[model samples]
Target: MHSVNTRTLDLNLLVVFATLWDTQNVTRAGERLALSQPAVSHALRRLRERLDDELFVIGRHSLVPTARAMELIGPVREALGRLDDVLQGSTAFSPATAQRKFRIASGDFVEFLILPRLIQHIASEAPGVMIEVVPLPANNALPSLLENGEIDLVISTPVAFGAGLREETVTKVSLLTLIWQREGLSPGRFPLDLYLERPQVMIEMHQREGNIIDASLRAQGLARRVGVLVQNFMAMPVIASQTGYICNLPGPIAQAFAQTFGLSCHQPPIDFPEPELFAYWHARFDADPGLKWLRERIKECANTSDE
Candidate 1:
């Protein structure tokens, strides 16, 4: 392969290529870039001539990337991201004047705890900014999502993120046992034997061999019966309120649910460690002012005093 001259290459074509790869339809790509269909086609032709390969081809309805396009996309995205960071770094970030969108991946709990305050702050301070919250990807997919710029930040419980990520502990949350207003149970600390006797509502976000509570119980040769297993924390409160089962949830969430469902919150009989919530981001954007500002805002919101 002959070396192509970088001076003769139009860097703008790479932007077009990335857009095309993302949209997969000429009209859609043109709409995203504010370019006409003919202009986009001409840019693709120029790129093909420069690289001596047809990077994409017309499929049944949309364009499909060739192996060459697949090979180029990763590096192309990285290059563009770095270039964006460099350009953004050159200017001071003014939240009041800047029009930007930040995407965050997190669980429903984070949405409940943080987003309301964050949105209020944004509305008052940065009317032009927008926040999009997406469901957290699986643990193994997190690094790629951050690296690929698919998500700007992640708010989650501590997890082992492999590499190229930065993390900071935002807050530590203790668990509160939520139970129905039973005859024997009171509003204070629950009794150990009573807690052990009652069936529990378990919140399992991921399918795994075992969880921290179970592992801790196993060490002491203790186990509780699970009456219901659920994927969503929001459902746990409803199930706990209606049934004889109990659920352990973060303090704020449990209190909120207790108020809404007319349930009772009690201190768990057993001592369990508080879980720390962390904010994670790609290390590549460590110096990006907008992300930095957003991270601070998230931290502040997470640490807000309970009402």
Candidate 2:
């Protein structure tokens, strides 16, 4: 491939490239861009000649991207999205009119605490917008997923995400224990001895031991008996309601689960540092008006949840 300065590259060809990449057919790409089929083909030809690569080729009646095209697709789409946002300027966000699908990475805790309220807020305020909540990816993959626009936002522990990402404190959380009321355990009588003596149901979502509470216990040279290990916090209500095992959870989540399952919510025998809830996003989207709107709404919901 011959090297050419990007300054001389026709910007219109990039628009064509992005359209064709999305539509994958010359005619459909032309329809989207309001250009003739020949015009779209001509742009592709010029792009191939200048870049020295067949960016796309016909395969099973669809235009499939070549290796080079695959490499360029992410940047091309991102560039076009940024450009579009700039053209829209401050007029970019109108919640009622914007039909966007925002993907969020979250855990069951945040889902219980914030998602319902956020959905209600969106339904009344931005009926056209949609949200998809996905499970938190492995820590190593989160940064790249945010960078590549695979996910728009993440709501998780403050420590789980860092570097290259922007975050805001969403909630301040403390620990509480959920146990079956049928276990003959009084809320006031859950002292250190009984807290340690019970067979606890530990939630190790993603193979992690419990957080601050567990650490505090270990620091005191104490440990809770593990009766079961489960991946989802949503299961805590059922497990604690039926079994004698106590489940330690974030305060708000524990209260909600306790109410729903007729379980008892108690303060942990040992106090731990309060962990913060946070919402994280890639810095690349800092200037994006639509994402800003979404974040603002989430922040509003988080504030309300804390109340």
Query: Which has the greatest lDDT?
Result: 1
Candidate 1 segments exceeding 4 Å error: 25-27, 36-74, 85-89, 137-150, 159-166, 186-189, 204-210
What is the Cα-based lDDT of residue 131 in candidate 1? Answer: 98
lDDT of 1 by residue, 1-307 (tens): 4467988889999999999887888888899999999999999999998888899998998899999898887678778878887775668689999999999999888898889999999999989999999998788988867866789999998889866789999888788888877645766787878777888888666325366667667788988788888877889889988886888888889988887876888887777777788999887677778998999998898889355
Structural similarity to truth (TM-score) of each candidate: 0.78, 0.74
**Model 1 TM-score?**
0.78
Task: State the lDDT at 210 in candidate 1.
Answer: 62
Error of 2 at 171 (Å): 1.1
Q: Give the top-scoring candidate (TM-score).
A: 1
Task: Report, for every candidate in turn, its global Cα lDDT versus the true structure.
Answer: 0.84, 0.81
Clashes of each: 0, 0
